[model samples]
Target: MSDPAALLRAYDHQLRDEAETPSAVAVERLGPLRLATFRGGRGFITYSTLDEDGRPATQESVLALVDGALAHYTASPDIHRVEWKTRGHDHAPGLHEALVGHGFVPDEPESVMVGEAALLAVDVELPAGVVVRQVTDEDDVRAMCAMQAEVFGDTPEFAAEILLQVLHRLRTRDDMEMWVAEADGTIVSAGRLEPVAGSEFAGIWGGATLPEWRGKGIYRALTAARARSALRHGKRYINSDSTEFSRPILERSGLVKVSTTTPYEWRRDT
Candidate 1:
């Protein structure tokens, strides 16, 4: 039997701790959680484990930690939104309820998929006239961001926020990469590859494809390109928090759905 729990534990130990925010304004520890404050009044919460053995987390301790984490961010005048990230494979009993009780609204859950990079680096047949390549210039970045916002059905402001962050990272980090697929002089799909610092894992993120271009292997081809890039960077594994539409594709590419993660958001009262 494939041990999903074992894989999750290894991911938590190896990747979670090593992937700290590069530009966080403030970061504090509250029990197992790392509470981080970032630019634009954003806050993030993540933890290695609530219970490492996959047993149920103690309710009292869990509640206390949640309260403490909330207090830490709530006391900050700069924080306007906080996201508490939770994983399904964790022993986080009452965690959802506790977060909701504290005014946190849950977002949709996503599959946590992990696998060898070699499996995803296979060459895929691209549609006629479709081409994929890495992009860095401002104009290319803006075009990629616009296409992604349209594909994901998000507002332009959302893409603008992402553009700012990606641009900042581009200036500071060489491990980040952006790829886009184009046909007939227009972008059809886009994605990001983020190689975690000090770890063997790289993440494939922000994968979006125009509805008209679905099922033509464009997304898979983009993934293959990112996986090949990861290998060149010495990363052996690829991980992603996948939506339902992309989960099967990653599974077919040999990534295992070891767990699910949800984000609970707390927006400060204006």
Candidate 2:
């Protein structure tokens, strides 16, 4: 796992196939792409690798694939927004221009981090008043989501939609778990652990902390809790799409930046 190339190979082999949409409500296929529809009018496009036929993807073929995926989502009236995920190491040639020409906007790219779950399972001492634990109750879940929104500056409507989706996942699925750090009965930090079925990878997602609560090991502790949970569920590897703030921390915690991922989004006009 220390060798960067080996880590990237392991990640591509074990994690990419089902990484994007484990909880998708419906899923379809378009050539090598998986067109996934989630509960909240969200659509996602992902594939393990674009070179499905032992040949690199050409500009024309990539453009045609992009158009086909968009057309499929556009035909579904309920899909208000769709995301076409692109990886830094992919062999796609005209993906960016094609997506832009087809009305897709790119988001900030994030590091695709991978490492041993055991490296993150160690005990980290939290601040004097802080404690981290997994939560399932509706009230705690809502508070966790609201705190994340405040920290990330998300719109109330967007936050509400995320809350509803989390609730639905909690009620319907057992593969995901929510964890939070609390001090004096208030949520200070929160995140989720998603153990991917039929894979050795578990994803630590939505790691957020209040500004005042950072630099006190609370976020790391919350991550450790989730890592332990993932280990208990029999997952060997930890993966995350990390922001700049969390990338250094995960790197310090033994995760390697295998690649980068950028999302190209397209929204239907209201």
Candidate 3:
């Protein structure tokens, strides 16, 4: 009775609409392709179905949309780099060559992963003198942000200034919180809980553990912390855009890879 494709499409739409800064965060139509910008210094490109682009729209319209959108971002001052998050299952045509022509470099395609929160909720073992807890202290948040920056290979380091800005925004609305795993006062792993209020879902993001501390179950433990937090907020489903390193773990925990996402990055300079 459930169509995975339809369900995935619906979930995608819900995430787009429920996000706080949903406009630029998910998809912003500049002309043809939707240009997406997020808080993490990341950019995204996507589009709605082009059924009405013409009397009988073809993939050419989609290609033009991408070209026009890139030109739009390259002209903006705020955007440093942009990525076109492409879905493998969508009715996209000529997207690959078009993106390459526009200077959008493709990253490895990752599973468009989905899972139930309950499946991931479980107690995990931390090393001796290690514990997982909610963290909001300036130092702890900054440390966590920096760890994330390292994991993503982003510069300008996710610093205290950026964390403060995020906190300032969180103070007015209480839909998100930060968590970290500490081993002997050192932040070993960290993540965030994002509640999509009025929806049956919450997102677990930024699950990272130091390389030396990994394979010892720290990632799973951090996920448990976030999943429990999600349940407390009345969220039933959990979602993440997972990479290869984490996909197997999620799959073992009962998540279904609903779709696939490929990011096409375009620069502002060329």
Candidate 4:
């Protein structure tokens, strides 16, 4: 068995710097952080060193970084939400405290799963009458997003809006693909596969399924479809920040949990 941590290290060293911010409208550097401004009032903060060197930043430095990023986003009237992504394996001392002190609310942590693409490409038995396929049309994408929102307990309209943004990017980003599983002409599960530019890894994101569809093999079928797509794109590995519900499924499908990621978010005051 290959070491999961080693694979994660390679992913961080080779992909973290460029794979992120591929769709950013603007990007700037502050110390070790990459400040990215995206469409839809979103701001993202990430650093390759956070995972590469594992150097712990002093509390003061962390605070300064937080303040700088917040100020950068707050100055833009269109920017409303900022996410400071933190990895559990990073040696960031007092980082969480600094973020909270700076008014960032931390979201739930998710498992960072990594595995070979071939391991996930095996055929999965879907529940009878369920069909999985790649979807590109506006109406199909909207339906998929709505089903995902309901599955994840989020606002359907908001999810659809984000999917629309992603759809716009699809015109230029052929590396990204969306897949849905349907039963009786209604979307029951949905997910996306993002093959990182100039990297061996692809990411499976936003896996969701209806409550009535849980425990079946529909989600796994959807994942396998993405994995097969990744292989076709020449990707060797698959990565995902998975919730508890999906982590076990991926693990059973041969992915390994290498770390955890938590996002600290700030919302602009209207």
lDDT against the true structure, each candidate = 0.85, 0.90, 0.72, 0.85
Clashes of 2: 0
Q: After TM-score superposition, what is the CA distance of residue 48 in candidate 3 from its true location, in Å?
A: 5.0
| TM-score against native, each model | 0.92, 0.96, 0.84, 0.94
What lDDT score goes with residue 85 in model 3?
Answer: 72
Question: In candidate 1, which residue pairs clash?
Answer: none
lDDT of 2 by residue, 45-107 (tens): 999977667877899989999999999999989888898989999899989999999999999
Ranking by TM-score: 2, 4, 1, 3
| Deviation in Å, model 2, residue 2 alpha carbon | 2.0
Residue 217 of model 2, lDDT score: 92
Tens digits of per-residue lDDT for model 3, 1-270: 134665586566766422534323345665444566666455666554444445333578767677677777776677767777777776667878888988889998888666678888998877788898997676777788888766666557435435645565465556778998888888888888888866777877777778888898888888888888888888878888788888898888877788887878776663
Please give the lDDT score for candidate 4.
Answer: 0.85
Q: Candidate 1: RMSD over Cα atoms?
A: 2.4
Q: How do the residues 1-270 of candidate 4 rate in per-residue lDDT, one tens digit apiece?
A: 459869778767766755777778789987788999877778899987642235566767777777887888888898878889888888787788888987899999999999999999989898889999999887887788777777777765456557657877887777678899999998999999999977888999999988889899888999999999999999999999999989999999888998899999888777
* Clashing residue pairs, backbone N/CA/C < 3 A, model 3: 32-65
Output the better candidate (1/2) by lDDT. 2
TM value for model 3: 0.84
Q: Give one digit per residue, the lDDT tens place, for model 1 in 129-222.
A: 9999999987898899888888787766556766777777787778689999999879999999988878888999999999989999999999
- lDDT of candidate 4 at residue 220, scale 0 to 100: 90
Global Cα RMSD, each model: 2.4, 1.2, 3.3, 2.0
